[model samples]
Target: MTAPRTGDQRLAGRTALVTGGGSGLGAVLTHALADTGARVVAVGRDEAALERTAAARPGAVLARQCDVSDPDSVAQLAGSLADEHIDILVNNAGVPGPVAPLTEVEPQDWDDVFAVNVRGVYLMCRTFAPGMTARSDGDILNIASVSGKRPLAGRTPYCASKAAVLGLTTTLAAELGPQGVRVNSLSPGPVDSARMRRNFTMEAERTGVTYEEAERRFVSRALLERMVTEEEVAEAAVAMIGLTGLCAADLDLSAGMVAR
Candidate 1:
């Protein structure tokens, strides 16, 4: 076969599975992966949202509904796709827990956060990593947050879960690297997503400031003084997947939150 043109898609001939592919950064990542010429399977608990993502990409994306935190669900999805060779897996499903001091946070609230952020990544890797061993070459990108590296006050649960994700990524990298599976975590600080906008609104109300002001203050803390965009995070994800030598490392896109 002739070599692809330089302008051709970078991820041509690859197949990708993105968890949390329904909304926010997840949806954007799905679009970005498909644009790179990969056949992407957008998996999430929200079937409608997954379908919407797929509709936007048409044939490039296949929408599948599966809750990454649910063992049976993950297993079922993995079983169905057992025969397919998956080149990339993005564990992006996550939840931002309530903003409050750890002392006041409910036990259940903490568990809920861990269920989605930590347990979700674990289940996905448990189900999919074995199959990837056959190929001995694939990418596993866990969508962690900078808060995991640098603790964020008033978000103990989120901070803790993401920290666990970072640890999980490191350990998994060691366990899977010899098999040729590159495992890493992509930790983005604060992205200008719809969910983040609502979070800004909450801060605005609580701090008695305008939404714009709250958002401005939020981004001002970053070295770039701006919120990272979803597309930027997707670009980082693409870059992480393209690298074969890098594993068990974190690709931070927090604009400098962790740096500070």
Candidate 2:
């Protein structure tokens, strides 16, 4: 087989499975992967969204509905895809959880966040990693966040769950390295999305500020003085997947948010 070309065709022969691929950043990543020549399986709990993603890409993207937080669902997904070889796994399923002080946060809300952000990654890896280990050739990219390292008040569950993902990615890299499986994470700062807008709105209400002011507070933290874009995040993910030597690493796409 001809080796895949670099740039837009670097992933021509690869197959990537992306969780949370139905909408938002997940949808963007799915499109990016397909544009780069990889056959993509876009999995998430939203059937309609997943269908839309698949419809957008036609034959290049396959949509599957699976809740990453549920083991049984994930197992069924794994079983269904057993015949296909997945060269890349992107654990991008996550939840923002309740935006409230820890004291005011509900216990169940916290669990819900971890269920999708932390436990979801674990379950996906547990079910799909063995295939990679046996084949000894694959890449696993966990979508973490800058909040994992920086303190984000009123987002205890989200921050903690992302931090856990960072830890999980590092340790999994070590365990999978000898087996020729590379594991790494991508940590992006506040991306300009509907989700972040909602966060900013909540912050504004919580702090008695205007929405624009709340947004400024977040942007000011980054040296770029702006929020990252979904395209940037998706591009970085593609780059990470193509970097064969990058393992056990956490690449920061946080717009210098962690520099301080």
lDDT of 1 by residue, 1-260 (tens): 99844322547788999999988899999999999899999999989999999999999999889988889988899888876788889999998878777898999999999999999999989888887887788889999988887756678899889989999999999999999999999989899888788778877876788999988877877888877899999988888787767899998898887677
In model 2, how large is the Cα lDDT of residue 239? 91
Instruction: State candidate 1's TM-score.
Output: 0.93
Q: Which candidate is the best by TM-score?
A: 2
lDDT (tens digit, per residue) of candidate 2 on 110-204? 99999999999999999889989999999999999999999999999999999999999999999999999999999999999989999999999
TM-scores for the candidates: 0.93, 0.97
Task: Note the clash tally of each candidate.
Answer: 0, 0
Give the Cα lDDT of each candidate.
0.87, 0.93
Q: Give the clash total for candidate 2.
A: 0
User: In terms of TM-score, how similar is model 2 to the real structure?
Assistant: 0.97
Alpha-carbon RMSD to native, per candidate: 2.2, 1.8
The 10-residue segment of model 1 with minimum total lDDT is 3-12
lDDT of 2: 0.93
